[model samples]
Target chain A: MPQIAQLAQTYASQIFWLLIFFGAVYFIVGRGMVPKVLATVEARENQIAADLAAAEAARAAADADEAAWRARENANRAAAQAIIAKAKAEAAAAREARLAAAQAKIDARLAEAEAAIAAARDSALAEIEDVAVEAAQDIVRRLAGAKVTKTAARAAVKEALAHV
Target chain B: MHQFTIEPVVPFQFAGYDLSFTNSAAWMLVTAVVLTIFVAGGLRRELVPGRWQMAVETFTGFIDNMLEANIGKEGRKYVPYVFSLFMFILLANLLGLLPLGVVGIHPFTFTSHFTVTGVLAAISFGIVLVVGFWKHGFHFFSLFVPHGTPAVMVPLIFLIELFSFMIRPFSLALRLFVAMMAGHVLLKVLSGFVINGANAGLGIGALVGLPSFALMIAISALEILVAGIQAYVFALLTSLYINDAEHLH
Candidate 1:
């Protein structure tokens, strides 16, 4: 066939061009273009990874801040509680001291009043003894139709008062 | 028949070698220029690539995956070579299908020529052979020797394996060339029938012409598919061969 016959005439140029063109394509595409594309993809991946990491770090920082605030709040509450407890103790102590002072004053008044009562009782007893002595003397004179001495009547009344 | 003709534009001869710039050579140059522009233009560093850039990326990825799958990650180095072969063949096939065959200015049926396919095949085979030897040295001969073959069957198996290895290039080249040539020829023949039928006065001629024209359209679609398939097959085999060379056994 002419096709088979034409092979010899055309083979050289075809082969030459094929090598040249194919080699050119290989170098331009393989060495040049491919690396750039791969780099873009890699760059994107790295950027995404970095962004996610930053977000996580920010979240962690927020958590730490929150925890610190809560701790501070708890510390302040505890301090307030301590102050209230201390004030209560101090108030109780003051109340007790005042109560003790009032009791001391009342005790002193009670002692003075008891002393006054004892003196009054002694005076009253002496008055009653004199009255009794007079009565006894009058009665004795009427019965026996004789007069008794003041000293005797006084001594007799005293003895009767002592026995009663 | 005229499509198969290779008319030399600039003729030269040195030591009995026909080193002429033929129509085929012109198309090759055209293909080279077009491919360079495509590769250069598609080089965008943006994260979101444009259509051209995406196409370029997809093309590279396709070859990359093919190499990795067939030949392992080390096969990555052969991406450019295999990618070039695929694009070159694919473009040549598609260009041949264009209506430019009438003017003959663009001799686009370059891939349909056996020499063109043969050269590509030979190059792939050469790489396989050279790399096999270079990587393995004298031990590359062991590629033909089947492991676990009995002593009695060793000679037969080795001869068969050696022959199979040698014919790989021819098979690759013939498969592509024949498919392309046959498709083009059939399309040509069908179109001729349509033209002849429509020219022969009205009624029955138009009826006969319409079906042939319809059949040509269907064949054209099929040819486009074939062009893609042949290109893929050529590149896929090249990668596979490279795999065999690189990994051995």
Candidate 2:
């Protein structure tokens, strides 16, 4: 009871100090500490957002690069296929030209061999005609005592070759 | 008995008022000093907070969340006032419970006096009044007259509402002051028993003294909890009152 009654006497000092202390605490915590804590929180939030954004950008860039590389690879393969097709065409053309040249040389050699055989056969036929003419003249002298001409013998042999 | 006594550390008078600095004032200074060191020392810009910084952050966040939950985002402007309110009262309560004379001085709680809580409550009530008028002008008076009341019941309801409104400061002050004062007094009484029992000699003394001492310790722990909760309740109500004034519903 006495304490309650004495509250009047004590109030002035208590309030005075309370105001002073409370004011001091308010400034220190309000001006000094609260902002720091808020700043830390804000900074963390901002950093997270930035990191996520960077990661997204990097991923996008990587995807683009991969797509470009794939495109280039496809293009190179197509180019290689075109070059192979062209090379095959050139090789076939070269092979065709060489084959044609070989066939022409074989045809020329066969014509020369046929001409030489024809000349030898003609010479043998001429010599056989002369011999036949002489033999015919000698046989007539012995059997019938009649002479045969070389022209007639040759003509006969030619007609016979034609018929055979 | 001397625990409740107010002795002036430096006796002075000004304008017929006892402006003398006393143990209560000294403890306030002590509380202020400790709070300054605790808060200001933790203001470093650490990416990962140290212990002191973490403690400071936790307290700020707790009050911030409480205000936001109770009063909405508009209550953020009152952070300094509410934060200081919680810290000062909480420290005063805890400091009062510290062992006396260990620091070669006796300390008293400012909150144990009705005057301290009275001032805080008055401030809270005053803010509500000023903000209510400032925001709504004459419309603030409508706070007492709820909508849809019949004409005959208006006066009666108005009187009741006005009475309740006026009781806010007194209720807030009494709740904190009485809790702190009574708990301290009860601890003092129990310790008195223990001392007396010890003085009376061995057999009956042990039987009375030990349990009394144990009970005192238990009560002190409970008082610590009460101390924290009371501070929280004070700030919470303050914010709620501010919200009511702001919204008028």
Classify candidate 1 by CAPRI docking class.
Answer: acceptable
For residues A10-60, write the lDDT of model 2, one tens digit per residue.
777777878877777778776667767767756767888999999999999
Against the hidden true structure, what lDDT does model 1 obtain?
Answer: 0.84
Candidate 1 residue lDDT tens string, B158-218: 8999999999999999999999999988988998888888788687568888898899999
- What TM-score would chain A of each candidate receive against the reference chain A? 0.66, 0.72
Docking class of 2: acceptable
The residue ranges of model 1 lying beyond 4 angstroms of the native Cα positions read A39-164, B101-107
Provide the lDDT at B171 for model 2. Answer: 94
User: Worst ten-residue run, lDDT, model 2 chain A?
Assistant: A153-162
Clashing pairs in 2: none
What is the iRMS for every candidate structure?
Answer: 1.9, 1.8
Identify the leading candidate in terms of TM-score: 2
Tens-digit per-residue lDDT, B96-189, candidate 2: 8888756777768878888889998998999899999999999987898999989999999999998999999999999998999998899989
- List model 1 lDDT by residue over A1-164, tens digit each: 33577887778877887777777777776566666665665576688899999999999999999999999999999999999999999999999999999999999989899888887888888788777777778889999867888789999998887888
Every model's DockQ, to 2 decimals?
0.41, 0.41
